[model samples]
Target: MSTRGNPWAVYRRLLSYARPHLGVYLLGVLGMMLYAATEAGLAGLVKFFARGTFLKHDPTVLWLIPVAVVGLFLLRGLGDFTSNYFPGWVGRRVIKQLRQEVFSHYLRLPTSFLDGQQSGHLLSKLTYNTEMVSAAATNASVSLIRDSLSVIVLLVYLFYLNWRLAFFCIAAAPPIGWLMQVANRSFRRYSTRIQNSMGDITRVAKEAIDAHRLIKIFNAEEHQSERFERVNEANRASNMKLVFASALSNPVVQLITSFALAGVLYVSERQVFAHRLPIDVFFGFFAAAMMVPPHLRRLVNISGPLQQGIAAGESVFEILDQAPENRGGGLPIERARGEIEFRNVCFDYAGGKGPVLQDLSFRVQAGETVAIVGRSGSGKTTLASLLPRFYDVSGGAVLLDGHDVREYRLEDLRAQVSLVSQEVVLFNDTIRNNIAFNAAGKTDAEILEAARAANVIEFVAQQPLGLASPLADRGQNLSGGQRQRISIARALLKDSPVLILDEATAALDNESERRVQQELALLMRGRTTLVIAHRLSTVENADRIIVLDRGRIVETGTHQQLLAADGLYAALHGMQFNA
Candidate 1:
């Protein structure tokens, strides 16, 4: 369903998430029925009091009335407890299921979709927006259900006493409903703005937290504070607008209800004075009429949360409704032979931009180490990304082992490849777990072996916990060389037949780079490795090198062959070495 569709539609979808806990929800409904029963019971007691105290003048009446009042209140308290408890129980479960589904959807969404969305905004929907939905689903729902029943039952009691007075109050409902409808529209608009402002606040705060070192080094604390202030003020202003609307709505509704009550008083007084109505029946009717206004006020107040929830739920449903990445065909392979080819491949980010790679053709023979050297933005990284199908080519096909890669199951295809990039991503976990991440079947003996090969054992032996030592976030506890080595160990543990090393040694010191290069050479053995690098020296030992410029191969040969030609490669090499 379109998120922009009717809000009632979005509301129904939110209710459906609560369907699995229907048995618990029904218990809450029974509580509401009990609460509604008290409304009629109170009106009946008033009539009995008027008769017993005024006309019967019985000596037994005083004690009996107080006991009946106490009994009625005790039952009401029990009703209140069940009504709040059971629905609250169901509300929490709904939130859990919603968060789980949304987070799972986040994991499966396409990379392209994620690229277009803000992480902070999405996070707000997961946390802030979901909480707003809970208030609407549970608290507001309780008021709507119990109070609506109260109003209906009280109105019925009023009609039983005297139909004319009940009819006059019913006439006032249309205008109150009109005012509520106006308030609902204002509430929805402000609620959507509040959610967006909250996203902006989260975004700014996250950016500052992630870049604390940068901000401190640049002395930009004041700048960041100003940025945060803008979003924070925006959120405050939006909330105030909702407050204004809510404040205005309640009194105006009461004012209209007051007018209805006054008119009923004027009409009923004449009937009582003319002896057309008894004082007891008039007292009972007035008591029931007084009860209806509070229910109407509560009903009006509930519109704000109800609309806020609808807006929040619509945003959440938008994420849940998105199309996940295609899982690809069913063709299965335990291990690929690692023959990769690009057949006149062309690609755009497909985000209203020109193609990044245009009609590019390339091949890597089984177990061959081919290095791609390029200047920045020359599509070297884009070319490497296509092999793993992080993106499908817009105009051509990427093939593996004489079959289109799209014909293979996505998981099975990715299983044959391993990646180690300059920006190493390590979770805050044990050193052993970082290397063994997603390497489901590897034995502990093999993990130690991969660690040793990648030079991670050099540092692990120095630590007290050895492989069990925990790393800081993004492995900040480790040096550049140490972090790169752990990533290499992770890639090495995977043992995939195809490997893409994207400037893996680019960020390290010269001594560290040299040491990592030794590990790289060891890891490259028996695997079809595609090495992307800017430094010409690293690719010199490769069996073949492809020099890329503007998304096309400008030179392809052995390193000496390109140097002898005195072209882009020779010039690039001369600039690095001769300078």
Candidate 2:
């Protein structure tokens, strides 16, 4: 359920993403082995030089020494290059694959999950957190394997030179390893804190950026800055804690190595002075002993990134493991007749926070336009939302054409409905693309027809590029009325049998609203329409008007009938007319 208990399990799961490129990873490992071998070979060469030149005093060895040094370094450079480049290549590929999966998963997540989550934190996980996973997948792994092998190889050579002194040198290993375990726990704790702090930083900054206009109008620059500073400081503090542990770990491990080196040297000097150890043996053993420190330092430094990566991997996997939106229905339909019925339906949000919608029953005949009017929090939007199964009813059922909505395949159920909400959303693309979004294969002529019907052609005719004109983010470049028209055009293109207009024309001015209303009237023909409007004037012409009070249907009748009754409908109509 949580990735806290076993970091290796998380890391192994992350590595599975890289399994497709196994050949590349194996090549990198081979390079690391070669690098370690070369390091050990250099220590052996040191013994050869000491024996040939100092002991035997051979002339041929003099020429051989320089040639051997150049050849050995050349192989070392080759090994280093392979080890660095191939793993780096694999790391970048893994990042791309992981980010794609996470992003795609977000798109299919249950609406309730999206409703409760902050977009900024989700973006941070996709961008920053996935980047950290790369360190664990490739860099930390390479350092771990390469440095560990180097240490092992050096110890083996040292043992060959003098087994007794070699055994003494590694006596510091147990304590150093214990220190690493302590540092590892600290590193993981601080890394998780740092990642969470980064998400907070992203959330605060995104809010400030998106509300820049509000901030300026209210002169809240200092207020926003102070909020940002707090998150920024928290992020910095978390990172520094990790840095402190990583910096401390290296020196402490090195100090332990230094003690071992001193003891080994002290014992070796007496052995050589008493003719118990050969000069060549002393030089080879000392060379290998010196080699241990750098390898030890690398092993110690790697724990920081490895733990950070594991933390990142855990966060990424958590999202991937979330249950996707339920798509479980065997029944399929090409299209619904647009008849809708809510039978004693009840609903609540994820946490079982008291019911947002109480027992309610209603029916809308096919090809009928029904208007639902209620004050804010009367569950009008929630009621419309259920038709397309955004959130399932907690009790009872929502049926379409005599069958439970859940019985229809999720895609088929959604395809039968089209929604235009108060909050219009448009991408940074051409007006034509926005209208035809997810409905590819629409010819230019078909797109033009939808745009014309929505009155979008009136505005596009004035732009230099017409329908091809690009919009700024969320269509910021367009006026409110223009953006609304684009959304209406999208719904028009969908041409679903069941249409939901949730304050669709709320953004339009009087003149634009009249024009768009004519287009909506044309689009609503032959479709079962559910209109949710705060402005009673907009719904006066519905075939039937249903007045809701706190999620219950209080009254229902035609406009004239409802007015004559002098109830909630009449009161709402009176308030709007007076305003």
| lDDT per residue (tens digit) for residues 406-503 in model 1 | 99999999989999999999998999999999887999999999999999999999999999999977788899999999999999999999999999
lDDT of 2 at 419: 93
**Model 2 alpha-carbon drift over 4 Å, by segment:** 1-4
Question: In candidate 1, which residue pairs get closer than 3 Å at backbone N, Cα or C atoms, i.e. clash?
Answer: none
Which candidate has the top score in TM-score? Answer: 2
Residue 234 shift from truth in candidate 2, angstroms: 0.4
lDDT values, one for every candidate: 0.90, 0.90
Cα lDDT tens digits for candidate 2, 106-151: 9899999889888888989998999999988788989999999899
Itemize residue pairs with steric clashes in candidate 2.
none
What TM-score against the true fold does each predicted structure earn?
0.97, 0.98
Quote the lDDT for 110 in model 1. 87
